[model samples]
Target: MKYTVKGTQEEGVQACAKHFIGNEQETQRSNVIYPDGTEVAAISSNIDDRTLHELYLPPFADAVKAGVATVMCGYNRLNQTYTCQNSKLLNGILKEELGFLGYVVSDFYATHDGVPAIEAGLDMNMPGPWDSMTAAMTYLGGNNASLWGQNLTTSVGNGSLSEERLDDMIRRIMTPYFHLGQNEGFPSVDPSGYFITAVTAGYIQTSRGAPPARDVRGDHAKLIRRIGAEATVLLKNVNSTLPLKTPLSIGVFGNDAGLPADGMYVLGDDPPYPGVPRSGYEMGTLSVGGGSGSGRSTYVVSPLNALMARAKNFGGRVQYILDNALIAKGDFSTLYPTPEVCLVFLKTWCGEGTDRASFENDWNSTLVVERVASHCPNTVVVTHSAGVNTMPWAENENVTAILAAHYPGQESGNSIVDVLFGDINPSGRLPYTIPRREADYALPITNMTGDQSRNASAWQSDFTEGLYIDYRHFDAMNITPLYDFGYGLSYTTFEIVGTPSADLLQKELPPFPPSSQVEPGGIPGSGMKCSKSRLSSVTQDQSPAQLLCSST
Candidate 1:
């Protein structure tokens, strides 16, 4: 928390820790169809106090402690209350208990009632062009202004809100800018004069008049390639099939061979400006997913292209096949007799506003893998996704290896080929647990189809697996995961022969510094009651393999 907040602040950018609370699932934020034929306000996460303190709220609390500049409330509900208007969340927990001096902002179009939102402690509403459907309730007088403008007047006139409170809101929002010298008299309006004056006053002095501009592309590319290679988690490998030898005849199958560049939306079929051809758009691979927060790159080097380039130098050849047609027809063969080795590229799309349709690799992709493995004993599967996907083909005898290259930015292709050809070692670890079945997740996620079928005001989600999020639930329930947290494989193996010990302290860690602790009960004078903290901690011994990986 300290690193994320302070580090970004030091970089001259205010780090806003976002989607403040209870924003785990993005299934339906606007409206939803319940089983019965009615539409509703969408599903909400109902988190008990124990769950909130132990699992959901700690990171946010830490962010506040670290002096994050801003906090953006999510587009969901905390318990039955909409988070943007939940006074307990905004005023009570965040401002009071956490001592968050930073202002609170609403998610895009997340603000509903203006007066209530302000009273609840929201300092700003973001990204104009409000939702047309809610315009009536959210519009103030002027052409694109939010309802807050008019609501504040009405509220103050009616004594529902005080002028002092409004001033407090303005003060909170302006405080950080003032501290950063960004207030009314700052010379953003005249930066040239400001720079000249600073230089004249010796505040902007430098040893050299100007520095030489270095070509950093090669350096940046090298760093990106290294990051990508280290992030390529080898999930499975059998019979020493990886780190392919030279003189390799590789048959590459699947459209994923050309992995897209980063910054693509996590939803949607194509880029927004679709009328223009791919050639006219920024030069790069297609997006991995779609939605807000997606990225776009100027250029992308696909795995197929990278591998082909690498193969040229090694006296090796790569046979390319677009498995789209084959998969559609359920003809999962390579057509050509499988070469000495087959590399299958697979990808699944998932992101904001939708859940994955299936968890099993046992689907069509599995069929393609099964067939390819059957023909060529050496078949390696490379999967790129926005999240962890279950691999039912893990036990497939013919499948030689599996690599999880989850969203490997622009240099992914180069990274994958390097690992395959032994140019770089594979050492990435899994970031999350992959349960064998969708049901195995800590909490049950509502399916999009099911929600779409029903017309309801809102779907109520209960976080029954309180304090047992992700691997915690698996540990508590003794459920075996397909891939445990931190699980990953590497091209090389090592054995550890020593154990380091630490001295045991009889003292109980000094009750934690006050800054790191949250006092029980509600905020001092809000009259709002809150539960005592039910937070717990779990520590697991690092397996020998993990210790070795860390040392490496």
Candidate 2:
């Protein structure tokens, strides 16, 4: 979050730290799902003060410290009260406790009441004038009267919402503009140089006879491919089953391997209405998440075809059999049984507007793999998901290997093949822990029927686990996860050298010289960079320094 804030603002664009606190789950965003499966419009979040400060607020604190320009509050209520109207969070915690000086903005249509949110230190309500025809249908209803724009003036007139508070909000909003050189007598800067279509009026219109423009696509193609390769992690390689030997016959399964890759935040261009052609690039395979972060490119390489070509180039034969119906039924007998090696591709799509119904795998995925693993002992599973997912079948005896190719973009297939054929060594690390079971997570209860049976107004979530989230919870409970955080595998092996013993570290160390006193090649240098070729030199180096190296 800090790097994102610094990187964006350094480029002259303001970065907004979003969903202020306790938005870990996306359930009940636009509506509430009752215990009986009935749905109604609502949203809520309930977190204790300690949990809020320790687990949730740290990232935002880092963002503020990094000079984030804006903070957008989420739509959910905090502790039974809507976030936009929660003074303790926006004013007491974010402003006073964290020392945030930036403006506070509300999520779209998130402001349920204007006066309370203003009093709570919310500086802006988005998509306004607050009097738009579309916003009126939702805000002007009897269920919510406080959100109407007139309420702000009425509250100020009644002395319920002070004018001083309103003025402070204005100051917060205008401060950024003032720093951006938007003051009086300052000439407004034109943005014609920034946008592609602005400089060339007919640039976007191919029919207007303007030749196709050059882009960075051709130049950065290798970088994108390398990124995909670097991000593909080899989670399990028991018995060294990967980088298949030549003179082999391979069988590939799963629709994901053949599907065109997609996973963009937003489409390059989207028509306001149907039947209108999108002006931007064509989306070949839609892999992106829905809602806010969704965009598609013109083309993507199929992992299946890429593997087939690679295998053929290596003098090996390949066969692809896609069985959606049988896989759903937990039967793998329909697939060819003669191949020496079998590879399966698994995918889970998630983005905006909805959450996965459960952390457990759907029947079509892990369950099918379990069945296939039993049938084909040489099978290797490659998983593609937007985030961490349950992996019960990970320990199956028949499964030779498991590769986590997390939502690799357009070149996903090429990257997978690069790692699989030993062209590129896998070096990616797991960002979060994967639990063996769904119940192992901090928030076990979700959109299940009986979970939210009580009232229609909100659902209560107690952070009874406190600061024990993810690996911390696992460590505290002494429970083994499917894969611990920072756990990963590689084709090659490595070992550290010249490391002090645990007993030596337990003893107090002598006073060390400051970095300023040490020369670049001094005995007690700040750090050392080691290479695979320097393995034999490990015992010879006795310098008090930390060594860094990447094994791939």
Top candidate when judged by lDDT against the true structure: 1
Tens-place lDDT digits, model 2, residues 321-382: 55544655655454454578788877665555456666643336766687667667888888
Clashes of each: 20, 11
Q: Model 1 lDDT vs. the true structure?
A: 0.66
Encode model 1's per-residue lDDT on 157-256: one tens digit a residue: 9999888988888888877777655654543343343443233223446425433332336657788887777778888878768778874687887767
lDDT of 2: 0.65
**Least accurate 10 contiguous residues by lDDT in model 1:** 523-532
Sequence-dependent TM-score of model 2: 0.71
